[model samples]
Target: MEEPQGFFSTGDGCVGDTVTERCLVESKEPVSHVQLACGLCFCAFPLDGNELCVWSTKDPSYQPLILRGHRQPITAVTFGNTVSPLLICSASQDYVMLWSLDECRQKVLLASPLLSLLVDEKSKQLVAGCADGQLWVFSLVERHHYRCVTRVDLKKKRETFSRRVESRLCSLPEENRRPRAHGLEKGEDMEGSLPVLSLAPCDLSLLLSSECGCLPSESAPCLWVGSSAGLLILNLANFELEGVLRYKDFRSLSIQVAGSCAMMSKAGEQKAICLLTSMFGCQIAVLEIRLAALMRSRQDLGAGRSLSVLPRGCVLSTSPLHFRIAEEHRTPPAPQRRTVQDQPLVFHSKVRSSGYATAPHVTMFSPKTNTRNNGDSPSRRRSSHRWCVTNLHFSYSFYAGDGRWLACGLANHLSLVFRADLTGTPAVFSGHDGAVSTVCWSHDGRWLLSASLDGTPRVWSLRRAELVLCVGRDLFPKPIQSAQFYYLDAFILCSSGPELQLLKCHIDTSKDEIRRYKQKSRCRPVFRLPTAGPTEITSLSAVNDFYSYLVLTAGRDKTVEVFDLNAGRSAAVIAEAHSRPVHQICQNKGSSFTTQQYQVYNLFATTATGDGIKLWDLRTLRCERRFEGHPNHGYPCGIAFSPCGRYVASGAEDRHAYVYELGSSTFSHRLAGHTDTVAGVAFSPSAPQLATTTLDGKLQLFVAE
Candidate 1:
């Protein structure tokens, strides 16, 4: 079998010659499995061979390192979950071997034929799932000793429960004549179990189709075990099975590989969690998991002390199996070279329109005012009118995921969507009775969500330029401070008063009032996350990546709270983040233009009134860098990371935007075009375009020269 070559897409929205194949690794014998470790190296094992080959992709000239220890063919291999990618575990029938690449040492553990392995670095635990329905848990003592914690027999546990339920039902008196359901087997004592095929640590970042944030913390950790029967979710807190999920249509599914990704739903622009499952490399299927409903049901089951399995209602909505055909290898296409800008960036002097531009060139001042003095000429009057549209400043602004559009929330109770270059006519979304505070674009860039002081969070269809869904203001306790699309737009996250609410909603644009009302009724709150402080939340930020589940929020009490959406709990807190309430928080959404390491995406920045911006690493929970010199006293002075993640751009009270290099503390560039305090800044995801909104209702557009 030939190994597939690795390729990276340029993401330039081109169909031909967009993907470029980098390198190809070859083996003398056919490789059985290959796994990449830390995005630096990979290990490949051949079938019917007792040795595995490890190659460092960083050095192309280096030869593959052969590691031999297993007496039998390796069944499974996994890299250790640690800060340093030095340890790896290989499983076989003889024993499970843990190898340290740095020291070239191995620790062997006598165990059964393990099919799957999971290493928990934080908890110092390792779980091995065998061909039989047995889960062996081990404790890693001081990174060397491996002591058996407990052995869980999933098959026996299910059998025991089924037998007890069957005996109780049989003891009851038989009913007279009853309508019977199809496939109802009489006296069926047990639900059959399947062998464990694969295992992955339960991570909200991994399960929710987001993988951009930090690793899973040690609190309430869980594991996802895939088998032919169903996917089993086991709570590592007590090493007990918490929930079992089976597809709605399929009775038996051989889930060899199971993962989640963001995909469009059949109903309009709503996003859904697509569960991709592979069966023994022969069959593939894509199923949809209603994450909000499933999570709600999980909580109800826990409250009722029924942890055997998830209800059928929580089962995924089944879809037809999809088969993928392998394409033959062909000659590589010529790569396209893009022209680089001559200068780094250039800012425009004239004020650019942001919101609700009805008349293209309307005269705001009267003819008498323009003729009064030479300073108040027609040019000056036109510039002044453009600078203060609707007499309302922008409250927030964000660039769309693809960098093609920009969304801005204004104080005049309106939301605006503009082209990145501010060339096309702005798409105005109205209806809010108060100032629009939060503006967020959907991952697909088809929808825009805005939250206002009126307490309503409205979803607007960008294509139709209409409101598709809106929540009542009476439903919330206080005004909404922040709102955005979370979990691939599967849930709407907003902060109201001191509570953070997660809502799962469906977008219905039906003309029928009754049908629209029914669809609106289907929108429900999955959970609420409250701040640790007594006061309300001041700011919040979360990455838009599909595999990120970490939501970072700031409190009025001068603290930063990190919530793990996967576990639905506060994972960590950074107290006294600033002397005053934190005003803004921004995460480094890695860019396609630059090749960043896996850990770079975990970095974030926070700023507060009168305080300088501080960069933090989510993994270490420590401040890595402090950027000062920019005067930010009253306004929030929103900050944003450049597309390449190498620079940070922030608004300032000095009537300018400051750009700082990540390695240095001093400001690198001072953008001095704004006439008032800069309110917010946004960087284009696809290009070197920077947009700044000022307190004087002026929008400035900058592009690479």
Candidate 2:
């Protein structure tokens, strides 16, 4: 008998290593606690057998390094964020132990039970929140000089700040007095203080300067401490409370988790930060605070001056404390249920429904020029040679303004234009030297625009299937991600890396070889709008519906920003729109070329990996609904709204297209046809037709019977 060529050899000892590695992860005891460090580099857990297992998250198949020293039940285990010599810290009833993975050495510190632990790499400090309403700061400046720097009694600070605030309020007139401030309960001063639950650092480097009118130094980081009563901002340098933020509406909230994220500012001199707090009672609050106000509060709390309240105007806006729950929608009874694959995708074109063969030549209005010399020559279609699908690439495709044509960008340095029904031969436009990434059509359906990774954008004359204008490579510093006809085709809009340019282009199809390189010089940038934080734009969307002025862009930093072209500035920003980078965004551009109501433009949808498609109202800047049921974790699947705006469609990793009613969270139809991950989806504006493309270079079309 012959051995299989791909089979592993047991004589090489591979089978024994595999068995040993598999058994190492198996334990008779269950894991009681688990904790993961900040970048998810390391994970630590305490087994029920009183043993601590520290494992590398990057490679979990290997045997975990185990440490056994704690005698009492481990209350908490944390991993430090240091790059080298992974630091593992654990707390017990007696003390806290720090284990260095590199040296295999252990250091012990006497302390009380800790609820939360944070290791600050910049300051070389270990900060812990104790169960006794206190904060312990340990300095690790040197191996031998490690010692407790200071301990803050949170309960004492809260009481003293409360009394100082009450005394100041007592001096006001009776009519001016309102409900007890800070959401404090009646006779709360007589009760005990709230226990500290969490601690996080607030880096002042996110802002330009500190409150004392000087740049933020390396040692001037702030600490945000969360407790049952409220949240307190403390100056880590002196361990003094700077400001307190309490929700007046939710007096019973016990804040357990606190976090912060920086916001992009229009002006480089000032920025803002959003402080987020989650309480035990299913309540969460998001407060946007300006850096100027925050630094001013720090100045007001100097050694000689004392103010316990947050500085006025520091908080730009505060969302009401509430929990977000996906609305469950009950599907209504229908006349008849239809399967998703009821209609089959027919391949109407014989030549892969893509490009033609010959290249068009340009001359200075010469009568000897042959009219059939364009790439759409009929003789080439009958030849033995044909365009290979192996080199073709499809990034995006869309329906024409009149719904009669479909344009698709290809990686083979060409774009294909065909009928919407996938019938008839596609008109091929070839000029780009790199893969074409984006395709846009003029509102009148006379001209088409395309962009490619070759760092140039070209305009094609649809009637002649010839390139009229092309931009130069030197104009853009990076490859163009997207380009389209904006403002009724009066100007061109393109996003190249982190910058968006609005250009006034003059179309010149004069193919005189002498002026061939002059087309790029005809276009000049009118506005250069860079995204906040200089984040690279992943997706761009703008409707040419009667020259709409709003341009929306999604950045790699998980932010959706709307630029007001009329105002020449960023109008609004939706920060942290999703947990990951937003890859697809679509506005409800109806099939009709006429401008519809403003509400139609206001409703847009955004999709990120793993996160479901979110419907947002531009006017309110809030998520109106979330449509899920499709798995899109590994790929940046495309999303689009139906022409009527009644339904939304998305491609998923499960090789199917999901269609959901706008008012419902559950999927209404699961269209199955593709064999690979569906990466792009588009709905026809003129008819009830849908098109989907897969990652493996396959296109499918579905039409309502």
Candidate 3:
């Protein structure tokens, strides 16, 4: 069978009978788990009517086998050995069913609510671990049906019935027999509490039991069981305990034998592999068992000793993320496109500790963005308390004139609104269909410019609380990366993906209409600067000297290119600006230095990681000096030079924000307050106050102390 390759496609089923609709597939329910065995792929999901559905790996068409014996949900399933008469076993709350894949019939092997199922060492028998703290052994030799021939009481087997003239605890050395106060006591009964969580087959269990008199001369394979107490290797032959791998605080939730994936040396000696999932955390430990160490060990097996097996590696589950540069949401020609009012998402603040300063707590409040009101901060008047009025990003945040209003673009396709005091407000702008990448403010602070991955650029008027204009995809085929309004909003200079475009807009404040137009008036690009750039520009900053201006764009390739709008060509390119990807570039928001009369621009560039900030002289087309001391993080640091151009502040991934003296380029004191990454930091335009935005959606304020 061929492995399914390429990226997984997602969409609704097609309608037409044409060739383009042939590959469209649909599912009524979501798949819970996927399994592959003997070159056949199986997807398992609980059916609507107390049934379990198993579907095969065929695209555009599906065939499922309905298994309906269990009254409860099916918790686990596994395939049988590679021998003749293939079998599949399922474990649920009611009983364990052993079914023949060829015959399509099954019989209850045991009347036990099982948690895990596995084939024994010889592959001729099955080992079922139940929630009743018992191990049931069943033989698959019968032609008609398998029967549970024996059962092992896990608690009794762990009691350590010694063959020699010595008590189990007294048999160990004086130092090794020390009592453990945390674990279970000798008389404590854990009968109903200790449920079998995970199970596997191991040969080492048999080898260890052979040395101790606990070995039984029976004919069954060995089974490894994992419980809340620790890991135990059981000799299924005579229902005796063999070996143990102990971990006190963590309980095992799932187990898998990586024996097939074991690494071997030139001498043909193979390493044993085991993967165990923790019940409390999303951590999976990969332990490499050495049979040599177990065979030649001195620890007494009579008094259950902890096997010194450390994890060779670990597998941590990562949060899944979905983002796009821009999604083309084309409006159908007339009478189709409609207005969409997005549902309000509960806004939260201060999810983590305040590291540096303690501000007044914004008791419990409902907000569209992460903004919460505290003390006497004003609140918006929204009739529906269940839904917030204004709503909710990263370095995507920008301050509008004197920092009266603040906007943050986020990955959730929403922008947050906050006042200069970092308090709650109801004036949030939301219409983007994709992740908001960058936001800019008009110099006068009246208009707000925002570009998103949805290939749409919108202009918002703060005074009017309305969406002024939207630059449609008809004028922008690619997503806009970064956008900045020229001096007074004459032409919006935008990083139109790999190139640049000067989109023109008219200030029509006279029309204060509360409506979404299906088809807005289309405007063409007045100026275009095309550079078949190697990568999409992630950061853009435009500096207009009151005439034919210049825009600097930082690409993923770690190169910065200066585009002269007058010449309509690339002026200067700065290579190796940083060791890693530069995500932010800030030109002095105030003006160039008066000392350098000929120079027009001085910019601060920050990379995703590596050394600190880099200052560039656009006149010389080279780096002046790098500002070190601040640590780099994954998210682009919210970097900004103070209005006076005396200091610079940038957010850090480590829940801290860094301050630097622009002249000395040395590290200053850090604003330490926040539990998560400080995503955006900006200095107040009017005062000496600093504002910070965190990933958890809180806007923090700090005074220069």
Best by TM-score: 2
Taking the candidates one at a time, how many backbone clashes does each contain?
A: 7, 0, 10
Question: TM-scores of the models, in the given order?
Answer: 0.45, 0.50, 0.44
lDDT of 2 by residue, 95-170 (tens): 6889786444212112346777778665566888876677877766543155565556787666655554454456
* Cα-based lDDT for every prediction: 0.59, 0.60, 0.53
Winner of 2 and 3 under lDDT: 2
Q: State the displacement of the C-alpha of residue 600, model 2, in Å, after optimal TM-score superposition.
A: 2.5
Best-to-worst ranking by lDDT: 2, 1, 3
Clashing pairs in 1: 209-546, 209-547, 210-546, 210-547, 210-548, 211-547, 211-548
Worst lDDT run of 10 residues, candidate 2, spans 355-364
> What residue pairs are clashing in model 3?
326-453, 355-672, 355-673, 356-672, 356-673, 392-414, 392-415, 392-416, 393-409, 393-410
Please state the error at residue 116 of candidate 2 in Å.
29
Candidate that scores best on lDDT: 2
Q: Write the per-residue lDDT of candidate 1 for residues 449-495, one digit (tens) a residue.
A: 88898999999887789888888877789998888887556678899
| lDDT (Cα, 0-100) at 464 in candidate 2 | 82
The total number of steric clashes, by the backbone 3 Å criterion, in model 1 comes to 7
Candidate 2 Cα outliers beyond 4 Å, as residue runs: 1-402, 510-521, 593-597
